[model samples]
Target: MARMPSFLKPPKKIAKRQLELRAQLWPDLNEGDLWSRHTHDGFSTIPSTMALIMSIMDDLSKNKPVSSTYLELWNRSFDEGFATLAKAREIAFHSGFSSERAERTWKDRLKILHNLEFINLQSGASGPASYALILNPYKVIQKHHERKTRGMREDKYNALVARAIELGDISLRPADPSPPPTPMAPPAAPFTFPLPAGSAVPPSPAAVPSAPVPPTGVPTSESSKV
Candidate 1:
């Protein structure tokens, strides 16, 4: 077995030292109205690969930069794996689409995001893009790379892949294919009434009783009458 190289190891000690130096240099940095996830009531986890993801989105969208719009959506998301995009005008306004066509512009960017597979849209009472399921950007980019999608910059994709590798991010890998469904057992035969224990065949029907004949004396009317 070979030992790992020191250069390839993480710089934990250096990072600690840097943090100490930063604290010394700016004592007030952690004080007074600062928002920290530890003390904050509302916060959402954002991916560190967001910059690269945005670059890829811009490339795919051809000059129309949708990164800001994406950020708005991410900001509104509460880490619930999905977001309600019912407030389209508000989101668009925050994303710098405050013109008369603000919502329209926002919707166009959303469509681009959907086409790139960064998010899955579902229509609801709100509108066409009433809800959005945020996808793992790493996986989406990996798929695009595999497909050699048009407008994708190779260098950016390469960097994303390298970053994912460094971070030990397995999200870029394809999901396991689901197993095939188990075949159902054949249906049981139709039910039938069972015969008696000893009898091989079903019992025969009883004979019908015939009408009784008239008495001999009572038949005199037919013999002497008329």
Candidate 2:
């Protein structure tokens, strides 16, 4: 039996997955709700790149778990969308650029995607080179949509609270009516004797004077003051 050479050994299983993804298309994908966020995030600046990426998305539709897309970037033939290179050249002409320029502009947006960590450029041995699509834009845009939805919900909840306060619907119900406030006890009058209808009352008694203390161990005359 002949042993297989190292070069003849098949690449890893993930390599096959990448090859498969390069051939599929996602039919039910929706981005209508995400367009506003796309505009907000300024992904609209690179029309050429946008076109190229969307074409890649159409071809790469497997939508694996986000972890599967960490291959750095993805490559595509310039003719991914068009039937042939001639047609791509025609479209490029209509877009006011040569086929090479349009291709260059689209690939050059790798600079924009670099900071975003979306894709990284790679060179090929021959033919057109490709880049690895680090993250799925669809997934990122989906997260943006999720955040936007949460924000809207929070705003709605806040508005409801504000309206409740405005209409004075405070405390859910009316709060039991507060018991009646506990009746206060009346203050007492100063201690005094009352007079009868025909009898007069006695005057208040005067305080008695205290006697002075005598001098201790002193011989005193009767005339000396103590």
Candidate 3:
């Protein structure tokens, strides 16, 4: 049997020891209002390393930290991997943008996040940012690091990688390339009406008989000679 690589193995003992220490230091920690996804009615699961991810996102943006905005989206998202951002004003307010330009500021942050590939947007009845499909942040960060994206903080990326390795997270790996689009079948030949069985072909315009013309000086049915 092949031996598993040490680097790939999770630190079980260390994690257990940390948990024991936490229990000792805060015995009533579990009794507090700490929310758990399993027990909570309204909660969304997010990565444990979200703080680091947010910092990385901030670095990539090269502007104000957009962590609050991202968090708001996450909070609104369900397990379905998408979020309805119909209440743009509410999201903006919650994301700490309470000024007259709050919504605009939120939109700018959304654009930054979109450019970084963290979330995909689609316009809907609500507005331009009506719907947001959250991407795997780990994969996004990994790709950015691989591509050497400008403004990506190496230290934060390295920490994220180490944490992912410790947690045996597969999301850090690249996804399989999507299959090429199927070619569209040629537009069906213009529909033609099938001739009915035993039906004769219709005569051409020239073959059809036309009304006879009266001679230029001759009286017709409407005119009588006296």
RMSD vs true structure, all candidates: 14.1, 27.8, 12.9
Candidate 3 wrongly placed segments (more than 4 Å): 1-23, 26-39, 174-226
lDDT score, residue 15, model 1?
Answer: 65
- lDDT digits (tens) for residues 34-113 of candidate 3: 76443447766789899999989888888777889999999998888888988899999999999999999999999888
Which pairs, if any, clash in model 1?
Answer: none
Off by over 4 Å in 2: 1-100, 126-129, 142-226
lDDT of 1 by residue, 1-226 (tens): 5665667545989869977897999977856556655444667678778888888988877788888888788888876778898888998999889889999999999998898898899999998899988888878787888888887889998888788778787777557999999999999999988877898784799999997887867756567676
lDDT of 2 at 55: 36
lDDT of 1: 0.83
Against the true structure, what is each candidate's TM-score? 0.68, 0.20, 0.65
Candidate 1 minimal-lDDT segment of 10 residues:
31-40
Model 2 TM-score is: 0.20
Worst 10 residues of 3 by lDDT: 31-40
How are the candidates ranked when ordered by lDDT, highest leading? 3, 1, 2
Candidate 2 lDDT score at position 104: 53
lDDT of 2 by residue, 194-224 (tens): 7778986678899999977678976567646
